[model samples]
Target: MQQTILEARHIQKQFHDPVTVQVLTDITFSVNKGEFVSVIGKSGCGKSTLLYILSTMDTDYTGELLIDQELMTGQSDAQLAHIRNEKIGFVFQFHYLLNEFTVLRNVMLPGLKLARYSEQEVEHRALERLKMLGIEHLATKEAYRISGGEKQRVAIARALINDPHIIMGDEPTGNLDTKNSEHVFEIFHELAEVHNQTLLIVTHDQGFAERSGRIIEMEDGRIIRH
Candidate 1:
């Protein structure tokens, strides 16, 4: 039996930009544990919109979202915030690290915020994640001082600090050069293969999508392939 990490059922979304516009329609899918799934489509195809709903960040949609089989619909803001901190890790196109903070501190922020472990434990876990990404030596340096690829790796380390059940990325490699993008892809691949991590990434990169374990293609606010 396969364990599902995240499931979206008949999810529909609309944007009331003066005139109403449907952004996503009847989006249904499930990502199983250890699965590396990619969501790909042309721009304005609602891939990012669907990811927002799946990550529990945008609640203005219809239907149900289940993480680890727990219903996410209609949850209070506070409850949802806690759930996000504890269960979902996020990576965006840009590395959003606090430039003033040290690499270690940037990674430790989420674990510290979650408050599931002591400060020492969080620090230990952050270092472990940085080490896992092979960026431990950069831990003491300021975030703004690192190279673009290093900053992105630090962002990834920060995402893993809480040992999140699923990592959702929106164009994680979109900002990287060829070498760095390949490196990031290798990291994601190893994570699924060795750590059994579940990942749902939205990207426009065709090569990246094809290399993933599965691809979910979207078109005109609907999923055309899965």
Candidate 2:
């Protein structure tokens, strides 16, 4: 049997500012270990909102989130921060690499912040991750000096530095061209197939969604299909 690594139940969210609007309604789903799941939806259909909630970045919603079989909803902010750092890795559309840092240093930042390993151990592990992404050769380069695809690969390496249980991407390929997007898709595919890394990606690209292990489609704040 496949083990579920993450589960969301009865997720509902409302936004109140100029007006009160329900962004997510009755969102419920589960992702299994090593499964690459893609969430697809039109813009403003609450895909990002749902992802934010699932990511433990937005906690003002009503629902239950179980990650690794632990109840994560209603947790204290400090608790959530720790879980976000230790258990989850996030890749946004932008690479968000610090331009002033070396590629290797950028990858090593999270591991150092976690402080689970000595500096030497963290450096070794970061190098290993960069090698896994085939970017070890660029480790000494400044982050601003690399190509866009290379930057994305470095971001992936950084995400893996802490050995997160789940990797979440918010339109990870949204800013890339066709070639770069395809490259990223292949990397994500390999992460699931070879590394057994669980991934939940929110993407507008249909081709990307179709290639994932599972696709969840949302419309008007509700999951229309899966």
Q: What TM-score quantifies how close candidate 1 is to the native fold?
A: 0.99
In candidate 2 the C-alpha lDDT for residue 56 amounts to: 94
* Candidate 1 accuracy as lDDT: 0.94
Candidate 2's C-alpha lDDT? 0.93
**Which ten contiguous residues of candidate 1 have the minimum total lDDT?**
48-57
Count backbone clashes in candidate 2: 0
Off by over 4 Å in 2: none
Give per-residue lDDT, candidate 2, residue 53. Answer: 90
lDDT of 1 by residue, 71-183 (tens): 99999989999999999999899999999999999999999999999999999999999999999999999999999999989999988899899999999999999999999
Best by TM-score: 1
